[model samples]
Target: MNFFTIKTSWSNAEFILIKLCMASAYILIGSCFHDFFENHYSVLIGVFIITAIWFVYQWLKKMKSHSDIPY
Candidate 1:
């Protein structure tokens, strides 16, 4: 049940599914409010950039952890 540790296939699948759903929701909402986004394009771009960086950081961290395993 740990956030960072996906020990089972089912848990891993669920985690991926949830992440995808959240990402999709973000995109869908942004597109749905295209006019509002156009008015605040800079802010929206900044938020997306930050989110992308954070996602990359987490991916790298996960990769590093897995690489450290003895298997």
Candidate 2:
């Protein structure tokens, strides 16, 4: 629980930059493997997996910060 002792805050610009960087990495990977995701089903599955991962991350973060509240 005390693994990370340093607490740092990111500005809006920093958050935006981080998101842009992550998006760029995704785009680069997608372009490099264009053939693998050419089919509609593959694209759908990729989107679903990404959405599920994001949902889980948000749920965990919320639970950690607000343990008393049930969502």
Candidate 3:
């Protein structure tokens, strides 16, 4: 399925399941890297920075695309 397509038929249970799975995956990955980092606090800070930059980048890209359309 395409990432941009809207699913009108998804139920609340399915949505919750998806969210739970994603959270589980994130925790698992973070735990895997916990041993490698000397300082756990820095890892969190780095994740925050990277996530913020990615969010801004996606927002700007979406805005640019919207601007290209004639109103």
Which one wins on TM-score?
1
The clash count for each model shown is 0, 0, 0
Give the Cα lDDT of each candidate. 0.57, 0.54, 0.54
Relative to the unseen true structure, what is the C-alpha lDDT of residue 2 in candidate 3, on a scale of 0 to 100?
A: 50
Candidate 1, 6-67: lDDT as tens digits: 43223464355346546655864776667655565555555666666665666666666766
Task: State which candidate, 1 or 2, has the greater TM-score.
Answer: 1
CA lDDT, candidate 3, residue 23: 51
Per-candidate RMSD, Å: 7.7, 10.8, 10.4
TM-score of every model versus the real structure: 0.50, 0.40, 0.43
By TM-score, how accurate is candidate 3? 0.43
If the candidates were sorted by their lDDT against the true structure, best first, what order would they fall in? 1, 2, 3
TM-score of 1: 0.50
Alpha carbon RMSD to native, model 3? 10.4
> Per-residue CA lDDT of candidate 3, range 4-52, in tens?
6522344565455445445544654686667653346555555555555
Residues 1-71, candidate 2: write the lDDT tens digits.
34355334445654553454466457546756786644555555455566556655654665466555443
